[model samples]
Every structure is written in C-alpha cells, then in structure tokens.
Target chain A: SQQGEEDPQALSIQEGENATMNCSYKTSINNLQWYRQNSGRGLVHLILIRSNEREKHSGRLRVTLDTSKKSSSLLITASRAADTASYFCTPGGSGAGSYQLTFGKGTKLSVIP
Target chain B: DVKVTQSSRYLVKRTGEKVFLECVQDMDHENMFWYRQDPGLGLRLIYFSYDVKMKEKGDIPEGYSVSREKKERFSLILESASTNQTSMYLCASRLAAYNEQFFGPGTRLTVL
Candidate 1:
C-alpha cells in the first residue's frame, strides 16, 4: 500500500503556537500532498512537494519531504483557533493510474483560543 | 475557481431504502471520485469516473454503484441502504494534469 500514515493521531495546542504533524509512507513516491479539513467539512488542499524538492510552503504552512526516510512533515506556524482541523497526507506517483491517491487516518488537530 | 457540490449536506434514510447522492463540478474536470469518510478509517474510495460513461471500482466499492452520464455530474447509488453504509460521503474532482482534488462539503448520511 502506498498510503501515507500520519503520526500522533491527535494533537492539541494553544493559539499562536506552532503545530507539526508527521507522515510516513512505505514506498517511494513522485510527490506528496497535504490537506486540511475543518470539523464536519470537506478537505482543502494545503501543499504539494515533489520528489526532487525537499520543502514547500503556503502562507503559514510549511511542508518538508525526505525521500530517503520516506517521511514528510507539515508545520503550521503561529497556529490560530480557526486552524483547528484534521490534516491528511497522500502519496503521489507517476503513470496513468496514479491519480487515485488513497488517504490514511489523518492527524486531528485542536487549537485552543 | 474549482467547485464541487454535493446534493445534500445531510441525509437520513431507512434500511433497505434506495439512496442517491449527486455531485456536480463546475471546473469540467476529467476525473471525479466518490469516497466515504469514517472515524479511524480515513477516506476510502468507493468509485471514480475518468470520463463520461467510464467508471472504475475502488478499494471499497461493495454495495455502491456510480453513474457518469455527463461531464460534470457523477452520482452514487446505494441499491439498498444498510446501517453499515452510514458515513460521510465526499465528492471530489480534479483536472487530468493535476493531482490536487477539489472536494465538496460532504454529505453526512445516517441509516436507520
């Protein structure tokens, strides 16, 4: 399975603090993508990092990928109460059938105001 | 902007009743997918259509069927709703060249 498993199934933090979540996959991937979902809402794409790239950033969110370790991490700087949500990662691959990115149980985040 | 919309944000149905969940995307994406989200199970793909009249079963396609009669519309049909089928159904669409998927608000289905 090329599924990306997120560590620390849940996390809690105070507003304005930084929150980090880790994801590890079993096999090599061409790229990796992260998504955020609010309570009872659909997921929103956060960022994507390719194999040749080590890090990418979007607004206050930063993502890093280590191909050698087959792991990726998402860092949210200065987390806000509105940032309380679940984060998910999915492995990306090449080929005609690589579009069906399967997701794993995500890391649920809680930011207290 | 890419927008995916589901028929309902919440749905309630009794066991053995037929259910239909509709999804529409305004981006004219070539790929559309249906998935069910559950606690601890993440998101499991139920079905996906690459183009009109093209459908493929995903990891968990049992008890679920899909129809893609038009480019922007994809419908998921449950022949006989069951208690185990109760879940949050999500619809997503993506361009063929991109890996990022645009998702709908999701429909929370409750089966009694």
Candidate 2:
C-alpha cells in the first residue's frame, strides 16, 4: 500500500539555499524516513524520525514529525549542486518485521550551482 | 560497509523472454525487497522475503515472481517480460527489526 505522499512534486533551488520538503501519510506509523536517489539509481538513506520524537537533526538536515497531522518535513541547509536528486519519504510500521517501508511518489529536487 | 549488489545495472530483452534480476547482500540481513520505479509513480513494491525459501507478493506482483534460496540472495523473475516491465528495478535489504533498508544501485530493464 502507498501510504506516504510528498508535496511539491518538483523543486528547484539555488545552491547555498535551504530546501524544504513535506510528506503526508495515511495511517499511524512508528517512524518516517527520508531517502535520496540520484537519477536512474538506488536510494540512499538520509534520516529517520520516530513517532515519539517531534524533531531531529543530522548535520545540516533537520526533520520534524507531527503524528497528529500525520505529516513530516525535511529541511536541508546549504544545498549544493550535488544535492540534485529525488527525495522520497516512507511511512513505516505495521509491516513485516519493521522492514516494509511504504514509499511516496517522491519530490525531484534540482539544486542549481 | 553494508553492501547490496545487483547482478546487472542494465538489461534488455524480448517481450516474451523470461527475465531475472538478482540481488545479493553481504550483510546477511534477514529481509529483502524488490521494487519497480516508474516516472511520476515512485517506487512500488513487487515482492519481499523475510527468510530463505519464503516469499510474499507486494502491491504490484501480477507478472512477477521471486526466489530466495539463500539468505544472502534474492531474485525477481518476470515470467513473460512485457513492455510495461521496462523500468528501474531496485533491491533493498535490512535487519529483521530495522526499517533502515539499504538499496542496490538498481537494474534498468528494457523490454522490446
């Protein structure tokens, strides 16, 4: 089942600017994860925010989750040209062994240098 | 490094040919997943296995089947490749209790 849905299907941002992406899910989840995918390739794990945690940060990345709203946001600071990739947010929980992550349609981000 | 390696990065086959995409993980994880990606549609799960010799169908598993004869390897098979099967296929794996799946570089299959 496709549970997560991200907003702003595509985004273009200048290098050094901050990029923000939002994701909304259908049902309750134990955690929400963010991933990055280069063109025609696999996804790289970025960050994961748990249901009990409202906010978390990793280096220049900040993630906030609101269980009430069933939404989450990922903020990237100081974006670079290499940041050009597709960003996907996945909803987790109620799946097999906690490994089933229902992914969203993803937001394609193009960072201009 | 937890590495997930796919057998082929790109493949091309006839419409009626049987196609196989293999994925191997060196981490010996207990879970493996195969997904197909289409433009504007994101990633859709085709199958997943949590143990050897066991497989489960995913959201879109109509023309696909899977094999997990070993814990470190999983294979996705297309009984009869169709043009619609032309897409990027990704393989992922993670520990049984972990949701942080590690993905392979993907196989771009083209059916003509």
Isolated chain A: TM-score per model?
A: 0.94, 0.91
lDDT of 2 by residue, B4-111 (tens): 999999999999999999999999899999999998788999999989998888889999999999999999999999999999999999887446899999999999
Q: Provide the lowest-lDDT 10-residue window in model 1 chain A.
A: A92-101
Pairs of residues clashing in candidate 2: none
Give the TM-score of candidate 2 (chain A).
0.91
lDDT of 2 by residue, A12-111 (tens): 9999999999999878887889999996555999998889999999999999999999999999999999889999898887554255776778888999
Q: Which 10 successive residues of model 2 chain A have the least lDDT summed?
A: A93-102
How high a TM-score does candidate 2 get? Answer: 0.95
Q: For model 1, how does the per-residue alpha-carbon lDDT over B1-112 read when each residue is reduced to its tens digit? A: 8889999999999999999999999988999999999987999999998899999898899999999999999999999999999999999998873478899999999999
Which stretches in model 2 have alpha-carbon errors above 4 Å? A95-97
Question: What is candidate 1's CA lDDT for residue B111?
Answer: 99
